[model samples]
Target: MNKSNNKLNKIIDYIRKDNGINNAIEATEQASLLLILKYFYDNSFSNTIDKLPPFSKVFLKGYKSHQSRNGTGYLTLNNIFDERIKSNSSFRSFKKLEEFLALVPFRVHSIKIVEVILHILDEIQVDESLADDYDNLIVSMTNSSISSGAFHTPIALVSALVKVSKPNKMQRIYDPAMGTGRFFVESQKLVKDDFLHFRGNDLSAFACLIGSVNLLLNGICIDNINIEDSFLYEDNKKYDLIYSGVPFGKPSDISKYGHEYHDYKNSLEGMFLKHTMDKLALEGKAVLIVPDGLLSNMTNGFKDLRYQLLTHFNLHSILSLPSGILLPYTSVKVSVLFFDNSPPDEDVWYYDLALNKNINKRTPIKEDDFSEFISLFEKREVSERSYLVNKKSILNDRLFNLSIPLPTNEETIKFDKAQEIAQLNSENLKLFSSITNYFDVTSRDIKVENTDIRTIKSLGNLKTGNNLTKSELLGNGSFPVYGGNGIIGYYDKANRDENTIIIGKVGLYCGNIHFSEEPFWLTNNAISLEIQDTSRVFAPYLAHLLRGLDLNKLSTGAVQKFVSIKKLNDIEVSLPSYEKQVELSNYFNELEQAKSSLDKLLSSFNEGISLLNKNIILEKVIN
Candidate 1:
């Protein structure tokens, strides 16, 4: 498996370096075309070309001729594939292949790159053993180039959703937004039967071609993989099972669906849910991955959608996935919605999967992580991590919110609070003592003549962040959005990583400095500071020094304060030796830690006092 993966990686690397390819998407598309051709060529009998299909024969003959010519051929393989496409008009796979090949920029340089790719593909004979490697390579390439709202569902999440759906034999399964047909591939594993039929639709021709190839590689062939917008495509056929991770934040013009869809025209997810509801056969089940905002957004469209889901369908389960599961593509916190077209149920099961660990490229979600969810999901059992919410409670609420309800237990809560208080109190005492030891570090006398003065420009670079409209912010997301003051909202994408220093750039909060410890989005109202030489000046010390310098006093403008980058760059500061700066930074960090502990200790006291008041009131009422 590793050997096959290495070869696949080589193909991707070669295409990525090729000058003909514009981006990863083009590289991935061209690579998929070559892979499909190679797959067919290797599967065909080289000893007997008479039994092979016309297209396969063309590919084999062309490849053999090219190889015979010492890999230096004036022959264009794309033209050979195009000729086969033109002759085989009835072959759906060939048409789809042509659609993908048409997008590739075939030039002399690209032909050389294709030769290298074919050589790598030739090293590994095509078989069922390469299926997993093919899927992984496609996913890796697709994700590496994912941007502009293009994303594929994680395999771990796909496997978990398939297991929960429990597809049956002979069921007509469908994925409306299937990227590379991952849902179908995962579903094939669970059903292990040839009776199942798979149908898929996608807007991207590249996705259609790659997905068709993926299905063929997995030993599952389907001719109904249509390349069109699933939303606008009119289909009366109902599916037995449907699963999708639809495109996020894309507006759908549902005017063609009639007046009833007017409310959902702006919300693509809402439209998709309604579409899924319409296309479900009697007793059909569906499991969709949607953003958290779809469930909790108080908009009328979202509320109406949730109301229909609760009153009409058997809304079985909602599994809240942890954030960062889609890192490097998006940071949207999402949840899985599992439902069936049966009569409405009185209760809905909710599971909150909190891994308590940072989910990044280094530590991605795994199949093992879903074992507990699957076990408890079968029986709809209520545990610490899983709970049930009554339909009446949801219906009676002013807004039909489907957010997961927290499991409440008084004794458990009290015990947890007591433990938290004790821990915080002990930590606060230790921090107070440690902070006092460094109290005099900042007050130490420094020889002014020995220090060197420098401008902020020499220390680092400062630039404004990307501009985002208020509507672009979500009610809840994985990354916090920072503006002039502090975090004003949340968003699904982050522009900066941890420990980044930000200064407010405009309005009332101009020149306000803040430090982030986690990945966050910086808006245009703030300026991000990137240190050029960390060895010369510590970042934390610089932040503290800037705060002490009172940057707000440097702001200009009559009605509103504005701190221009030019003014910030020209401001001079006296710098001590790197060692002294480190010492001062450490002292300030200790002080901040002590202050945080003190604040937490006070909050705990308030909680304890509130609990005591409640207990006294209860005692008096009982007496």
Candidate 2:
């Protein structure tokens, strides 16, 4: 992968160095064309010479026929005398009888770019899936260009959609906004029918050319590829399968296409929705990734569109997708809708794929991520993340809002109430028992306890933390920096080195206390407690005892909470034996661990309840 990426980078860098290339998008477009032409030409150099473009054939014959012993496949820029590439024609076209060819590199240092292209092809031939590596290269190279809004849909999403559609070789598949033709490419891997017809349309001429090459490489014919705005391009042919994830944003001059739509003006996605629906054959299935607003947007256009979907199409499934699926482009939340041009159904199965992880360019969505969703989809059974909803209940005033209910649970309401009652009662009994034991222990050692009742100042040294700014708390650091809330970030320097108890000195977390075992940098929001002598006191025991005190009541300031060092030092406390302190500290550690576990369990339980509510609440209306 590294070698393949390196070779791709070399080609893109060469394109970038060319004075004629204006932006990364143009570089990607040129690189894609060059890579494909080189791949086919290099495969059968002698036999394919006649198939090359006019000037390209002469250039390749001179470059390849040279019997160089030394392995430098560099060519001179002076040899590229092709005027057709610079002719006044669309980048993908040539007038009269001229054939198309990517413009040759113009920079002096781009002589060896052909070698890099050949290296990339070598890696790809070893594993054909590496063609996706080329796709990634194009996406990364073009990411900085303002004109580049087309992103190849993540392969995982394409695979999931294709599986759900259950495409057969006999069926005709179409993608209206086919960026690099990824949907068609991925579908070809699943559909085994040799006679499958693939068709696509896109607004970008470069995208159309790339999609054509990509489909050809993936063993799919590209006879039906159209380079026109799908919204305005009327087609009489019907398709058995249609899948698209249109660009999510406000489109330019959509009002021009208003006459073609039922509603005069709507979002780009809304227009595409109506377009695809009209193009579906009888009993044809279509899956689309649409913005979440489409389900509930109050505009008359969206309302009418949703009503049409339910009235004319069988809207079977709605899958709420996680955000960042199209990262570096748009973070808008989207959902997948699977509907057939058959009769409308009474119930719609909704799945909230609460993939809680964040996705980005660095971390992409993968095929395995859809495994569980596919399993649940096949079962068609309601689970924590899946539910069934009635069509009529969602049809409010003919608006047809299809937003699925967020997950929650009402069956556990009585259980929650009973647990709360039991928790409160247990706390009351434990408090009573603790106070009884405290009084009994102190009363017996009345004389001895009086000698040990010293101020906190004598028990330990309290030091205020050094102030650290946000900038200083980042980078490759060794020690964690602590603020009131604890471990705000990391820094290279340490102000203290000891097993110390951290006290929240100010703000909302003023009364909080935390323990640290390693060297750390500290901010002024907290103070550290370092005991002078451990034989007389245990650090953990003191921390637990201090935490039990009413420190919040002692806090000052009306605007923001604060605790002074003097107030903390002046507090008097009875001291237990060193042995008893150790015992109590160990017990406190166990108690803290147990509390942490219980907190996690409670969180998981709440999540389960939320998921349950999402499905069950809709049952009352859907059934």
Candidate 3:
């Protein structure tokens, strides 16, 4: 963490220590806002705290009264607070200033929060983006609602999206899901023209307040920062450049959108996609982060929405972000969809930024990580990480799944090397065929053998695993601890030692498959598998076979999806003889090895192709 981050965390910690504040989130938010307001006023009137906003003036009066040894100090503070709530709506939320008093405990400690604010203020200097200084605090501390689907957009991502859109002073901008207005502030910093106008809307009241303060302190007006459900709000306003990180997997309330919500409004992100398309001016451009499921979901509404996007807009680019970018919030993979309200294009570009970085809340992402992507993106050039696909190919795919496919291992092999290998293999095949032909090759007639079909329960035992809470995860234990989404952490002890298949039994990753060859601890969220007759069926082969089954489709659970053992047992599978199972397992293992080697080769080819492209571009440079 940097210096500013530590200071903000210190303030949050101090405010959270107050027992009087029943809602710690609300209290921290209010205090953070108040401290920021004071800093804003102090910057304007450095000599004294007077002439500040009416709200600040009232708070200062209470603080001053407590300092003096004259009257009932605490009572005097309550009187000022009561007066402010009656007069100001912003103060209404923080009705009991006593809670704040509790946070400060000692009247002398009043300056502690103020000092932190000032330190933050100093960092938000000429060149610093507001997000660069305060985004971490705003995101980490703000409350998250699953229904709202809103999460803090990383500052690095916000900045990159803003740059990608290339916001100008003359153009209008908007962020429908603008939490804390990070996008708005970043846009303001990039504006080179004289006139700049942007609109922001969010359903969360706390977000609106925090956003208002963030914009105000950044020297931007907050007149258009509306605190309303953007989906319900009616407006015909169009923008030249727009960007947003829409809530992922949230339900849409179509009741508010009226007839406009008739089609795909059943889907939350689909509704956001439609809304953005409708709000964009002719030839206008937009970049939004959407859940990857939206691209692949087979829902009628989602499919229609995908078609609508490709037909009505120039679906120019899709940037696939790897898992963990939104960690501590969601593990769902997301993509940045860049499109314009122009005629549909013949080809769309895609970039894969899934380059092996394990991003989490503790280990944050930096702008430099996106430098190569941004550089390649700005030039609209194809690299190992980027490619262009034909629109017709997308139209042919099921549900028009716009999810860009990264280069396969085979595709990554250079054309020359691949061709040479292909020729060699072709020659070898012909020679072998000639030898067999010369030897009078023949096929022996054999009867087809039938294998018995059996349910999972008939062949094995399935039971829920042990519970390994996030708090108990030591991370440095001797054995890997498996969860719904695979190894979450490590533990000191192993629960099971036999080779088995772990099936995600609960949550978003329900039905997901993970194979463990060594002893490991499995979370209760998943089901541990132990084949009763391993000689008849290889464990690895069964694991691979189970993986082919669409388990996610059978998942149950309203709030949290789950796949139960009963459901697994109901699905019948073919069981082969012991000798056949062994032979098949060996064959599968060889195929896996081949696939792994191909992946490595493809990865290398991708790197080589990218290098070649970059060199070609450099050679064309005038300098």
lDDT score for candidate 1 against the true structure: 0.73
* CA deviation > 4 Å runs, candidate 1: 42-78, 82-92, 96-108, 252-258, 411-623
- Count clashing pairs, candidate 1: 0
The deviation in Å at residue 6 for candidate 3 is 5.5
The sequence of per-residue lDDT tens digits that candidate 3 reaches over residues 37-132 is 444333433354445444444555665565564442333224434342334444432332233323322222344454443354444332133345
- The TM-score-based order of candidates, best leading, equals 1, 2, 3
| Per-residue error (Å), model 2, residue 542 | 67
RMSD of 2: 18.8
lDDT (0-100) at residue 590 of candidate 2? 62
Candidate 3 clashing pairs, residues 3+ apart or interchain: 149-247
Off by over 4 Å in 2: 2-6, 19-24, 39-57, 60-130, 138-149, 192-195, 262-264, 411-623
**Candidate 1, poorest ten consecutive residues by summed lDDT:** 614-623
lDDT tens per residue, model 1, 459-534: 8889899988879998899999999889989999999877778999876458998988788999988999888888
The alpha-carbon deviation from the true structure for residue 367 of candidate 3, after best TM-score superposition, in angstroms, is: 1.5
The C-alpha RMSD of each candidate to the native structure, in angstroms, is 14.7, 18.8, 13.4
